[model samples]
Target: MTAIITTTSSATDTATLEPGAEAPANAGEAAAAASEAGAGAPALTGEHTDLLETLARHRFFLRFTTKDLTDEQAAARTTVSELTLGGLVKHVALTERRWMDFVVRGGEAFANGFSEREAEFRLVEGETLAGVLARYEEVARRTEEIVAGIPDLGAGHPLPEAPWFEPGASWSARRVLLHLIAETSQHAGHADIIRESLDGARTMG
Candidate 1:
């Protein structure tokens, strides 16, 4: 079995953003640490700034899809697939959290198992739309904090041993950020469809 290394504690010192809050003062510094830097990480460059802006834009769309929705409406499956507005928000939060963990802890991030991947897609009993959105905001804030503190976007770790990943290949922190943006964007589109189906709401004109 692969060893599980804990990286969640790294974010303990970072400040949390409230729901719909803007990125913190230190947001968008993309690069893994060559050594611990925390709040003292270097200022953002054009690339990192652009990356964060694009990510924030897509994130806005994703969250906006759930606007004005009741828990029941958010949980309703509008498409043939199991996808729902609340579920998409929850899943995106989970995905972002895990990838940030990988950035800090590397391949050991997967040690938690795949069960979380499935469960986050639905609002389990007693779960609310407000709750999931709050969690997503927390995750997003953590991502910004992690990215802003790390010192080397060029730093990489070997890919986890999975069928979906190429053997022996690795990804830099930059790659991971791009992947996050893409993942969020894709899901945001799916969310648009679901929202439109639910009440003819579209993310765009």
Candidate 2:
């Protein structure tokens, strides 16, 4: 994003940079300003608290997408894609459980491939929306507990041989939390769209 050049450059709104400092002109400067501002925010007690906070933020959006929807509505294919609100809920929960396995265990966790992974993105029979939601809640609570007990956020394991993940990369526990954020956020958007199509409902105003 383009930042304000100078305090005198604009009168509509003053961009908050350092005191008497000119606004950033580049991404690096913008990041620096943001870091400075964030530094002034209250310090988090630990990485677990920080990670859980982020996880909870994205989780809210995802869960909102499923709110007030009937089991049939959640399973309905409101969009051309196979995604449904219930399916997305199930998918994200399984994702968290799998990633948690990666965090606790390593490459040996679930040695499977794409050929066996497509089922995850579907709300199969017997998996009600409420049931899936409860499962996700359990996973969320368990994840917070796991994160709270970690020594540090630096723990990690090499990624498995999967076609989807980046090749030859190891993810730190911190990165795992970031991945969780991405997982929930991307699906949250999809879920929101599906939810709106299913009815006139929206996850956000």
Candidate 3:
């Protein structure tokens, strides 16, 4: 097993961990710490700003895709194994593609092209971590470009397959961007915990 050291520093105290470290087991304690740290933060600008800020904060976890680690190391799991930083990047890329392609672009259903959307959770053989990360960046950039091109939030787009999205259902492009940001931010939290367990490398700082 490989190891990495992490240091937690405060005004007057410092603590160190060995390569294989167990995070504080108390969930409440962890939540409390995070809440205390965020207490004085100013109000967020808007829905888009709030969501984008959340996603940017977790970009550190994406760095693991380029780090020297195997699929197992990225996942930090031994049993019922299925999760990795690379896999998460792939998943996010596919997710962004699906939302933009299907929901926004109103194209052919991805389900026909990729039978299992959740396959992103499994790392396929021959797929390098670097390649996955690169693809993720590409998709993210494209999504941003598409979002920038949209000028109206009330524009109606056809959703041929979405039951809830009726043919005339309209949504602002801003709403879609915010939704994607929220989704990515949620997954980034998952990546943070998985990465920390993998090598004791803290994702937050």
Candidate 4:
């Protein structure tokens, strides 16, 4: 189930990033800028003008938080729980793979060890923080490739077998992408709070 996030800010024009900074020239720059901005800044690029701006924004958030941390730091718990910045990265990667493979491709089976759909938020023992981040990066790259290869965002794909998903129902590629963006963005918020609570690191620009 999707969690409801209530904000006083306007949803249509909410600032996901700081003003005065130039839009990133590439994914690396975008990812770095997102880390500096923390969760307070816009997740999307101000100069972004694409059919997949929403998807890009969501990707920005995921990459930003997962960028530039030492394996130990990424895995370190700021609180009493098992959630870590790295763990969140893994979770997003797992979700991306599942959505793309199951919902988008209508695949009945998935590759082993990439993720466990039933255990969202639960980090398994012996899963190194670095390993999780690396896997997340790989999965994200694959997802990007898949999205780019699609000729039409309006093209339909089968739905997963869930109560929320209708049997034999299909979704436009656009909807699937948007759902990913929204899902990642929300989790990024959770990561932001967890990071801050751990070390008092404020959100970046």
Candidate 5:
């Protein structure tokens, strides 16, 4: 799929870098910003709150690693791997959007194409760190809205045929949410290493 770019430069945008602030100073602040960044969505409790909060915390860590970075630095590969900080942010956002579509629309969502999978990991001409960050924030907000408003987490669809997935299996919205959490967390670690190598900054101690 061609990467979509929908960016908003507002300071109040969720998980986005503020106008003057580079990024959240620490994980706590990042988490707090993520929580407070939401609009007046109805209050959630129990499993919904727990899952969203945990996911938000991890998302904060991932985005926090990109503090004070230039577009050149964000796109540069620090290690032998092809992964770059900007690329991870973009990739994760795209993946999350795809999965969310699946959560609502089922396996048909994948039929469009993943032709841009490789490009998703690199910054193309005109793609900037701030632009990608803004796009990610948009995707994140949409995710929060979708999950929060959905009536049931148990609603599910059959898995698309893939070697990585079990045959004849299905996944509920809850399972998809958990998978997104795991995927984002894993990529956040990758981004942390990339960030630390690029500079001396660490997302956590």
Candidate 6:
């Protein structure tokens, strides 16, 4: 369990304590403390700013693919994958939120968002396109907060043990941000094809 925990109460009072126990490791925590600073300040320059911009632009393109879509159209699956535009939007938004939460709270963030795999990619009944878009906006705002506030791009925790991931692999905050951008861009492409199939709509003007 490679977790970087610190007291939320104070910055100068930083320490990596064992889970459920309180003990300060002054020397080891020095790097960790510096790594977590600027959580409340603006993110300017460096990789964080670049990643934020890239993701924002890609997300804009993704949203554009679904413009002028009706609830029926958004929910209609145009591909054999059984993926709807609305569902893709939901997935990207949830993924961004989850990755950003990881930046703040590490592996624990996964439990906060989607619990079931099917629910993530499925558009349930009574789910309005407007409502999902609104939720997506909320997630985008939080994603921006994460990219702007978290101090260290290099800071990371070991990935949860899983066969899907390399054993003992870890993802730096930077890598996580890049992954978000990649996923968003990829889904945006999917949305484009789905939109084109739905009513000959295209993201490219």
CA RMSD of all predictions? 9.3, 12.5, 9.8, 10.5, 5.7, 16.0
Clashes of 3: 1
Off by over 4 Å in 4: 1-53, 66-73, 76-82, 107-115, 118-120, 166-168
- Model 3 alpha-carbon drift over 4 Å, by segment: 1-61, 64-66, 75-81, 107-114, 156-171
> Comparing 2 and 4 by lDDT, which wins?
2
The superposed Cα distance between candidate 3 and the true structure at residue 25, in angstroms, equals 24
Most accurate candidate by TM-score: 5
Q: Give the TM-score of candidate 6.
A: 0.75
| Pairwise TM-score winner, candidates 1 and 6 | 1
Q: Model 5 reaches what TM-score against the true structure?
A: 0.84
Per-candidate total of colliding backbone pairs: 3, 0, 1, 10, 1, 0
Q: Candidate 3 residues 4-78, lDDT tens each?
A: 000011210122333454323322333234335445643233543343334433432344322556655554453
lDDT of 1 by residue, 18-87 (tens): 3333232322221122113334544465666666656766776677677678999999998898999999
lDDT of every predicted structure (CA atoms): 0.71, 0.67, 0.51, 0.55, 0.75, 0.67
Model 3, TM vs. native: 0.61
lDDT per residue (tens digit) for residues 69-171 in model 2: 6788888998889988888888888889888888898876666533535867777788788898888867876776677667779978899977777899898
Output the number of the lDDT-best candidate. Answer: 5
In model 5, which runs have C-alpha deviations exceeding 4 angstroms? Answer: 1-29, 33-40
Q: In model 6, what are the clashing residue pairs, if there are any?
A: none
Worst 10 residues of 4 by lDDT: 1-10
| Candidate that beats the other on lDDT, 1 or 3, i.e. the better one | 1
- Model 2 poorest ten-residue lDDT run: 1-10
Task: Write down the TM-score of every candidate.
Answer: 0.78, 0.74, 0.61, 0.63, 0.84, 0.75
